[model samples]
Target: MPPEDEPKVEIKLCSENDLVLLNKAIPEPGYHERRFASQQDGKASYLLAWQNGVPVGHLLIKWEGSGPQVNKYLPDTPELNAIGVWPPKNRSKGIGGQLIEKAEGMAKEKGFKQVALAVEIDNSRAKELYEKLGYMDWGHGEYIDEWVEKGDDGEETQHKDPCYYLVKNLE
Candidate 1:
């Protein structure tokens, strides 16, 4: 159980099995698998957000120079690589925001001067959440080239930009 006021949200250090669970929570195809592979082969710090033994969110963090897909928006290093709350279970429960808060605190404790993350400009929910949490809009708009498309067989097709970049600096 977590301390009082923390809402008992259990955050777990990710393992391979948890990868499947995380993938189910996130809509992005192959993202969890890729992150898991990266972590397995010596890579980033990954976290899975769970509530009462049920995985509801996913948070994958990697340094800016280390290779976040949206590194172009980051200033220096250590960006929050990926964050997503399972749609049906998300419901403004503050799960994603709490994970971000935890991420910032962890980064600060590690002597990091700053942390960063890029949200899709079109994702008003994410953008609003970041802004409310004190994440300032820093860089201008930009888009990533590798696009992901849904195929007829429910497969993902890598193509071009799907959304605009909206970076926020963690202070």
Candidate 2:
């Protein structure tokens, strides 16, 4: 549960123009900026949850499925990826759930019949959240999740992690 003074959270789709402002709200550097750029380029979409005008939560809507992060097993299924809530203390307060619901609404609006996502096999907390929200583990499969981080010198470093895929029907 959040503290009594925590501000009410507002969830909405992020536009390209909101990138700069949203980046400021995220304490971590580069992460939100990369997501914002992806959204701006139409490669992905995001639902940002703001509390007191600061982004405290976010969920990424990926129409392309998981790509290298997971196999293209469900090619037609849009994915809800990178769901997060800020300031560890702010978790379990319904903010993540609200962001997920908003992402589902967006997916339905886009004409998708269902949605998919991958969770690290060890992340029971996140898996539980998704399960509570109606996502189901179809089964376990291995995939090399990939990511790239840019250094201050403008060089990119790549990394990969293994994960399991999950799915949910929006119908």
Candidate 3:
């Protein structure tokens, strides 16, 4: 059970209908576009945690074929990526932990034996959260994270970042 200050939330896979709602609720730019594209291609699963009909957090589970690191460490495992909590004020209330748990459940349902993810070397806060949720630093390796977004003028912009890999056995 959550503490008195933490609000209760329901975590579930985002449906096609939920995509529209997520786009409106999430303040981060390009989040909706990326997740929507993944969903349309059936390459990823987006899970959202709702509290009082509002989205409090979200996580993405990308299939093995989509993440290079997952293919290398645990080829059959899904990669839990792009996790975030909205409103900044809603953080540290167990919403992030709940999102991770929901991602693990989805991976298990898909027959994956493990789950993997990458964290920026300097992101101590996120690293700590993953560790607390049972994810461990399996090894040290660099990954080139890339994404493309469209500008208001219809031009596309690409971004990249380097990160370290982590994994967790679901069994």
Candidate 4:
């Protein structure tokens, strides 16, 4: 683990512009952080993965609401919505996991009972990382028929991707 006060990395409050950068970082972003931030106060926070003063990763949290998979499950659960480390150059350096831990810490600081998130069931890398860090599955269901799985090589696979609800008990 990096030092508690690593100058190269920071977990800070963000504005609307941060959300735009986060959307660009994640493949299919669903919500912009600023808009969500507009409706929330005292219960939300975002963390940026910075290195050498560049925003290389994003970790945005939100109160319980339905994200992409809400149709398959209710949206009443609070969660850390979008977390992504940008580009090949910025990934696998432990930033993604760090942001999640930071977000979970922040959520606890803000007094949320537990933190929840939705992940594409097929993304084992992300899921494994989450599980290894103590996040657990609460529920899951299949895609909306039009969805198709794509491999790292960009080849389509018949596996219908299901989205899962993941939770981390804060207390």
Candidate 5:
């Protein structure tokens, strides 16, 4: 059902070298290493999408909630964090959806009946895509999305955004 010229996409768990490769391609600096450490610690899983042997997209599945609301409400639900397709040219073309589908399957395999993720309030494109894949607004109010950004000066700055959670049942 795909065009003949469409590049085949393969999804796999991120390895240490693959983490380095993806960092080189996307220049996320320490982000990948941090996620990789989480993966090593059994706290998360980092998945990468490859096109023609090049890393094109990534998704992180946290085994437990990282926020107060999520911890209070969806305590056992694994969270899908930081799902993205890179290079600007890879937008659409179903790559992002494929990564999500893979994440859903993984969650199901792990015996989880539900999965959750948060979307920036303004990210309608991603919200629409998630809805298409059966995710629904979690109805809980917004929470502050938090992360750290390391600067060229080797200093880390905390960043926050307003986001709300969404959930999907795997049953």
Candidate 6:
């Protein structure tokens, strides 16, 4: 049991209605919408962590790997992407760990031998968490991470993040 004041967190597969609530809570423009579409199309799985019936965090599992290195090497491993907990105040509360554990379970259920993720070179905190969870550096060096962010003005901006890959084998 958690402390009385700690919010009870529930993890679930992202639902269509959940997107509306998430958008209202996080307001990331078209981010959730696009991810939801990919989930519907069987290209990915978007998991949402809800606290008090509101989305506080999310993790996206791409059925196929991303980046030249991931594609070239771990082609069959699902890649966990864009994991985060919002409100800034929610950071360092184990929400991210919960999301990652759930994703690993889902991948195991799907018979994947391994799961992988990328951590930005500068994000020492995230890297430490991944390491504590048994994710090891892939030792393939770093690569440029690419993503698109949609603005409130309805325009898309491409981002390039320098990151290294990590991998974990499922039991």
Better of 1 and 3 by lDDT: 3
How do the residues 5-64 of candidate 6 rate in per-residue lDDT, one tens digit apiece? 456789999989897899998887788988899999999999999998899999999988
Highest-lDDT candidate: 6
Which of candidates 5 and 6 reaches a greater TM-score? 5
> Which RMSD values do the candidates have, in order?
4.2, 2.9, 2.3, 6.5, 1.8, 2.1
Give the better candidate number (1 or 4) by TM-score.
1
Task: Give one digit per residue, the lDDT tens place, for model 2 in 1-171.
Answer: 444744588998787676777767666567777777788788798788888777788888887777744444565787788898887888888888888888888889988888988788789899888998889875656655777878767788897767767799999
Q: Pick the candidate with the highest TM-score.
A: 5
Q: Which regions of candidate 1 are displaced past 4 Å? A: 1-7, 20-29, 65-75, 143-156, 162-171
lDDT of 3: 0.79
> What would the TM-score be for candidate 1 when compared with the true structure?
0.73
lDDT of 5 at 60: 95
User: RMSD to the native, candidate 2?
Assistant: 2.9
Candidate 6 Cα outliers beyond 4 Å, as residue runs: 1-7
Using all chains and alpha carbons, the TM-scores for the candidates as numbered come to 0.73, 0.85, 0.86, 0.65, 0.93, 0.92
- Count of clashes, each model: 3, 0, 0, 2, 0, 0
**Please, what are the lDDT tens digits per residue for candidate 3 over residues 44-112?**
988889998888788888885435644665578777888899989898888988889888987888888
The order by descending TM-score is 5, 6, 3, 2, 1, 4
Poorest 10 consecutive residues of model 4 by lDDT? Answer: 140-149
Of candidates 5 and 3, the better by lDDT: 5
Candidate 3 regions exceeding 4 Å error are: 1-5, 28-30
State the lDDT at 50 in candidate 3: 97
